[model samples]
Target: MRGKYIALLVAAVLAAAAAGVGTAYVRQAGRPTAKTVLPTHEDMQSFVQTANDWITERQKTADLSLYMADTQNGWRSDGQNLFHTTDGGKSWDAAAPFYDGGAADFLDATHAFALAKAVHDEEALTGISVYATADSGKNWRHLALSGAPYFSAEGITRGVDGFSMASSSNGLLILAGDPAAGSHESVVFATKDGARSFTKQADSLRMPNGQNTLALADASHAYLFINGSAAPVFMLATTDGGKTWKEQDSGLSPRFTDVVPTYVPVRMAADARVAMLSVQNGTPAAGAKGKTETADARMRDVFYTLSPDGSVAGKLTELLTDLPLDAKSVSMPDAQTIYALSRAGGKPVLYRFQAQGGWKRVESATLPADALQLQFVSLSDGFVLQKDAVFVTTDGGKTWVKRPL
Candidate 1:
């Protein structure tokens, strides 16, 4: 229902890599100490980086790619191995599984789906392949797609660089030239019947040209977010399942001179009408002829909320504009209650949003500065997944109890 976990977690992993530290030392420094009550920004960064590495290492060793759990059940897989639990992630049972090492989507306890590369001649990738399991990963079957787009003809091979599965049957796949070729063109394909069939969405979506991702509220409602090097960010949405899509004109007119607008979608609300997008202004570097420029040192960590109809309805809010910390997660439990977490001044800061008040800091002695992900099942019941453990909160993060995985 919310955006996928990998979106924010990937940034955390990069933060660790960029900091040039290993997971072992980072984890050791992350422990809360009696002498140091609050972790500094560097401490929190190490914690995040360590946690990201822990998860990655666990996935690799355990042969699992993801972990998804509700109140009473959980699911995990790594393409080759599959595991499920009935006791709220306390223990898991191994099942016979198939490995594709591809992007997967889970609808319920028994049904799951994924999209992987379909190669011909045991060496050449010819098209995108679909796989499914209805018995909680006990077994899987490759489904035949009806309208999938292919870039392979004659001697050329266009590979599937990006793929997203929305539901058991609906998904999108992007085809492009060699990753080293620096091609700006891409094609998108859509499937509605659990990958039993597909329809070519576009040959060239243009502007946010190549790299892309997907966010879907359901089988009928989905959005495509595109990322490009020199182009403005773009978004496309479909209300009638995946039958048709229209670009959500991001009315991002930069107010500052000598710069251009670059908007990135951080989180999309459940209603799909409201979304939080990160805004950055880029200025051409000196002697680079407006061709190469670093992020304006003056660029503030600004975020704005807009409607799918392309209206900036919320006041643009800036957090620690003087610092370089960026937001990792944003959650809207309801239409009015929004929560966000970001790194600033070398520490993680939590924020709560009110109707009239923009965003206010949440102050608590027990609040964690090293959380990797936040999952709010309700207004009062939420879970914060960290590097070494998971924490449960019933009083809206005022207090927390460590829950074992």
Candidate 2:
């Protein structure tokens, strides 16, 4: 009975976010192009200055804050700055120098931590640092990790794939890494004393042979999704503050295509009931054997539910069919609200899903051609990074105005 329920849940979640078949776009040759309206250097400078001023004013009073990483350098640290806004992103401020990975968490209004990797000799794994700030964005303290670490590089550096921060509390931080060189050696680190020190906790969880993706419910609970192996395995709960973990039934087929991790589970209404979504490649079983033709016509399934008591619940919901060919990111602001960003019609589009309304298409504001990363900070606030600039929307993404800096 448990096995049957698990199978059903898996089917439901995967069935939810799939996209339906639609007409592809065709371009006509020799079409006249519209004139580009680029912002001037001075105009951009003034915009950034204004954003900084707005941030300074809001810091005077705000309960919580969300900061977005600049995605111009492919979300790297070289030329980007951490743009943070307190009052629902109406204004912005720059954080101190930090590496550009998708890892950051704010313990409070005046405290935050970011995972960064240092580059030396064209190699990014040499120096891995975690930057912490106690007084909001004023001053930053860098804590470096010795020895080569996986997933420390910014983008596709050839070693590890993704590095993320699961949870942080009481000076203890948990970081998850997917190393390419080491099979069955996905790494997770636990640091005491505010990342000043570190201890390896990868051995606690029995990760599968290939790559593993992880998400945290809070400082104490985390979920890991292992793929690329014969059968997919899941680590549902991690005790000892992410040091050691125990497995739970994922109800997924052994095969999955892509997995994206998120940090929004920490903000769920109940910390004990955490949620993570995965888009599984649903090509028929017969064609799954080949490498070339099997990759084509791959379907996607979006699964969302609660991971509690070593199992998932809350009815696996099927959201879409034949989703975007290059869907990059999906975020769940809450159990009921889900947002997905993908390139459609040669432009980025935002899709919103509510518990009651199903899926609705919404127009996204124009973004710079270079802007690549999109993150939904909250149900009402979203941000996109283009080069050195950050654009934010506070009213549920209807209008995305630029918040320079």
Candidate 3:
């Protein structure tokens, strides 16, 4: 059965590669050099002050306007106060907070929501707060939900894991979990009358061990990747506003964890019709001599699964063969383009794929000493947040510019 599953997985991956579904490459032209357009000291001072003030104010009143990409400065907010830029990280600004009172989500300029968790210390007490902002983060209002689960010290904590909102309406959905109490769950809520009121459609989802991550496609569809006892399991298609869900049998098995037998969904993406999950598995090798020695050394593999129209379409693809893994990150700019950030040969590297095409290296000059945490903002731009400053790249990372924060 394992062999059959593996064969099917390989076939599906090859088919996708052949279809040109994720194969595309761009070449580096010149020696990578940093542009001289570094952020000034005055700009850094202003940015730090703004960010600190935002955090402080949120702690005090929890009221603020969410704004992004003001024409004065080409700043785009990922959430409240988390800003990024395409024109060489020049300036910065603040935006709205998350639904659970953490940070906001900037799907674009106009449609965004925040996730706020009502927790004290490691315990989630009662009430989960969600806020949505229209008008490009100018104003935000509470999303009132009917029978939204109110948490007390006795109830489990619904720590916000991920959230999803639709572009058409103020409808919103949030996924949360309680890791401290060994509870993994998700909830679905929707607001039709602007951000005024929401309706709770489902109870929380309970996976075997816990849920590592959740991704929502829209108001009606979402996916949860659950870490099972020995393997990673996938829950797909939460229709009827996440009240009930169906398992997607992709003929793909997720990577397993030996420490606690838990699985982590490193990356997840979905469109209106399809969803993709990338899972990581770590296991002890067979050749090792003793339990302690063998346990210390392990092998890892990363796999990808696809769901077409909220249903499993095919087997999984072994994107990376057996090797020692450090950290992996994947980003889907659009439905057809995927970017992966991984550490190869002990150095950070970026790879890009257009549907059907195989992975191709994104050539960029060597980063500064101990420069890790490279984040790809888009296909054409990326950044590395370092201790001293944040580095930015505009030309497919071929050239970079530093912006001090």
Indicate which candidate wins on TM-score: 1
Residue 253 displacement (Å), model 1: 3.8
CA shift of 217, model 3, Å: 1.8
300-386, model 1: which lDDT tens digit per residue?
334555554444456445543322222235555555566666545546666676667876776655666566555554566565555
TM-score, predicted candidate 3 vs. hidden true structure:
0.60
Error of 2 at 188 (Å): 4.9
Per-model TM-score, in order, reads: 0.65, 0.57, 0.60
Tens-digit lDDT string for candidate 3 (123-217)? 32445566666564567676433223534344454554444444436344544545434445655566666446666666565554433334455
**TM-score: which is higher, 2 or 3?**
3
Which structure among the candidates has the greatest lDDT? Answer: 1
**Positional deviation of 334 in candidate 2, in angstroms?**
3.4
TM-score of candidate 1 on Cα atoms, chains taken together: 0.65
- Of 1 and 2, the candidate ranking higher by lDDT: 1
Q: Model 2, stretches more than 4 Å misplaced? A: 1-94, 98-109, 116-128, 142-182, 186-189, 196-206, 209-213, 226-236, 254-299, 321-328, 343-347, 363-371, 387-389, 403-405
